[model samples]
Target: MFISPPFIFEIDLYREVLLFGDGGQSGKVGLWRVWVRFYFCSSGVSIFYVGREFWDERVQVCWEGGGTPLERGILRLASLFYALGLEARKETYRLGLKEASRLPAPVVSVGNITLGGTGKTPMVAWLAEGFRDRGLKVAIVSRGYGRKDEGRTLVVSRGRGPLVSPRQGGDEPLMLAKKLSGVMVVVAARRVEGARLAVEELGAELVLLDDGFQHWALNRDLDLVLVSGEEGLGNGRLFPAGPLREPLRALKRAHFLVVTKRENPSLRRLLASEAPQAEIFEAPMEGEKLWSPLGGELLPLGKLKGAKVGAFAGIADPCSFFALLEGYGAEVVEKVTFPDHHFYRRGDLEVLRGLIPRVDLVVTTEKDWVRLEGLDLGFSPWVLKVVIRPSPRLLDRVLERLGMEV
Candidate 1:
C-alpha cells in the first residue's frame, strides 16, 4: 500500500477532527497515518491565522487580566525590547541631547500614554473650537497617521473646510477640518514644520497638537494627557504585554491629566498619586446627536431608542461605540470592527449590505464616517456625533496656564 502526501489549504479554527482506521489492513493504516498528519498540520496553520487576525485584541485581553499562559509568555518577552527602546528615547530628551524646536505662537498638546483611543481627537476639536470662539486664530498640527505624504507639511484646511482628501491628510485631521470652521489644520511627520507653517504662513495665534503627548520634537506650553476611564492603564505595563505607551512616571511631565468617557474614582486617585503636580480633570465623551451625511439632517440621540442598528467602526476601542449604542437602547444586531484607521474596501461595504435587511439602519462613528464618505455602502449610515464635555473650570485652568484671560 502506498500513501500520497495530502495537499491542504483551508483550515477552520473553530472545528477539530479526529481520524482512526481498523488495524487489520495495511492500506487502511497507511491512509489513517496520512489523515492524522494532515489534521495536525491544518490545526497548526489555523492557530496561526487566529493569532494574526486578533493579535491586538489578544494583547488587550492580557492587559485586562484575560489571556492564555502561552500568549502571556510571548508578550512578556516582546515587552522587554519595547521598554528598552522607550527608555533610550526618554533619556535622550532628559539629558538635553535632543532639543525640541519652538513654534512662534503658543502650543498646547492633547495626547495619551496608552496605545489606543483615549478621546484625544474630540478634546483637540473642543480646544480648537474654544480658542476660535475666544477670538484667537487657531491652527492644529498633527503627525498625520496613515497619510500618503507625511514627509512634507500639507495644509488640510485653511479656516474654511478641508482642502485635501482623508487619504492625503489622514482621517482625524480631515474630520477636524470638516467639523471646525475658521480653524486651520495641518499634517506633517515632523510637527515643528507644520507648527511653523501654521504660525508664519497661516497667521495662527495659537496652535493645537493632535495626539502630541509623545511628540517631543516640538516644545509645547501645556501638555494635556488623556486617559480612558473605561480602560485605565491596563495592568500598568508597557507595550506588547500591556496597553501603556510610556511608564507611569511619564505622567509627571503632563501639565493636566484628563480622564475621558465615564467617571472612575480609582483611576483619578491613581493618577493623583502618580502625578501629584498635574491637575486632573474628567471629560466624558458623550454622544451629542446623530446625523446623516447624505441627508444633512440631525436627529436627537433619544431617537435611538427601540431602533435596530447594525453598527460598524474602524477606530481604536470600537467596543466603546458598540456599548454606546446599547446604552442608548439601540439593539445592535450586527457589530463589525476593522483595524484602527482602516481604509474601507468594496468588500467591507458588502458586509454592511448583507446586514441591511436584518437591521433597521446602519450606525458608525464620525471618524469612521469620514473614511466611509463617497464609498457606496448601499445605504447611508447615521454618524454618531460625539463631543468631549470638560468642566468650565478645566477651560479656565487651560486659559490661565496659557497666560490668556478667560
Candidate 2:
C-alpha cells in the first residue's frame, strides 16, 4: 500500500489496523506490523498519541504560564491560606470578636478588591471635592503606601496646603493633597488613629478613607468599592493566584459600587447576582487636560490632538493610559510601561530620556508625575490629570448617608 504526503497515521495495537492521512484524504494504508516505519515527504508532521492523558494535563498547565509546576502549586496553596485568613478576620469583626474604632466625624471609604489601580485615588479626590463644595471640612486618611517614613502618622496636607513631600506622603496621598487644596490629607498605617487625629487636631467635619475597603479596623459610614472596567476581577481568584484582595462575597459589605473607566455589563451583572442589596454606579474616568509639572499651567487637550507624543506611565494600567492618549487624537509614537506603584529611580529616568527626543511631547499620568519631582528626563513631560465623573444620584445618596442635605 502507498501512503501520501501531509497525512496523519495512527495504529491500534490490539485491533491490528493502520490509519493513514488526515481529514483531507483520510483512509487506511495497510495492516499493522510489529516494527512499522513511517515515510513522509511533507515538510512538517505532527504525530500525537491519544493516550498519555496525565502528561497532556501537565503540559496544559505549563502552557497557561503561571510558573514551574512547583511554584504555581506553592502560590495556589498560599492563596488558599490567604483566603482563609481573610475570612477568619472578617468573621471576628462581624461577630464582634474584634472592635472597630469609630471616629467622631462621619467616614467614607474608597477602595478596590484588586491589588492594582481601579481609579480609587481619583474617586477619593472627586468625593472630597463634592463634600468641600457643600461647605464640609473634608479630611483624607490614607495608608501612605510606599512612603519612606514608616509607623509614624504624617500630615500630607493641613487644609492650608501640603506639609510633606511625595516621598513622605506616598504618591497617591501627595497627589490627593495637591489636587484638593483645602482638604486635609493625613497618612498613617492605622487609619483609625489617623481618622481620630483628623477629627481632633485637623478639626475635620468628615473623613475620606483612601484605599480603606479592606482595612476592617476603621468604622465607616459609607463604603464605596471601585472596580476596573478594563480588568474586572482578574482570573476571579484571590491574591497570589489572582488580583482579588478579598472574596467576591465581600462586595455585599459595600454600600455603593462604582465601575470605573466605563460601564461593564458583565461586572454589573455579576455584582447584581453577588451583591443584590448594593447600589451600582458607573463612573467614567475622564482625562481633563494636560498640565505642566513645573508651573502647573493647564494646557488644552487640543494641544496633543495632532501632536506626536511619547507616553510613559508607572501605573497598573499603562495600556489604558496609552489608549486614553490615542482617544484624544494624540499619535503615540512610543510608550514605556512599568509595574504598578513602581518607584522611579535615577536609572529609570535615563532610559526615558533616550525616548523623549523622538516625539513632540511626553505625557504621563498625574500619579507618575508625583514620583518625578527631582528627576530631569531631558524634557518636560506633560501630566495628564484625570477626573472621575460619577452619577449625580450617587453623590446624593452619599450625602444622604452622611446626614447632610443634598
Best by lDDT: 1
lDDT of 1 by residue, 1-406 (tens): 1222223232223211110111112101111111111211121122110112324457768887889999998888877876776666657667998777887789999989987789999999988999888899999998776666656689999989999999999999999999999999999767788899999999999999887777766888999999999988889887678877778998999999999999999999999999999999999988889999999989998888999998988888898999998899999977877666767765466555556667887899999988889887778889998888999788789989989874
The top-ranked prediction according to TM-score is 1
**Local distance difference test values of all predictions, in order:** 0.79, 0.75
- The list of candidate 1 runs beyond 4 A from truth reads 1-54
Model 2 lDDT at residue 378: 60
lDDT of 2 by residue, 1-406 (tens): 2233543333223212111111011221222223222322222222211222123234335334655878667657877977676676667678998778888789999888876678888888888988898899999998786677645788889876678877888888888887788899998866778889999998999999888887777788999999988888877777656667788998999999888997799998987788888899999887899999887778888888889998989776778899989999999987776544556654455545545556888889989988887776566788998888888788789999777874
Q: Taking the candidates one at a time, how many backbone clashes does each contain?
A: 0, 0
TM for candidate 2 is: 0.80
Q: Which pairs of residues have clashing backbones in candidate 2?
A: none
Task: Output the worst ten-in-a-row residue range by lDDT, candidate 2.
Answer: 15-24
- Model 2 alpha-carbon miss at residue 269, Å: 1.6
**Shift in Å, residue 24, candidate 2:** 66
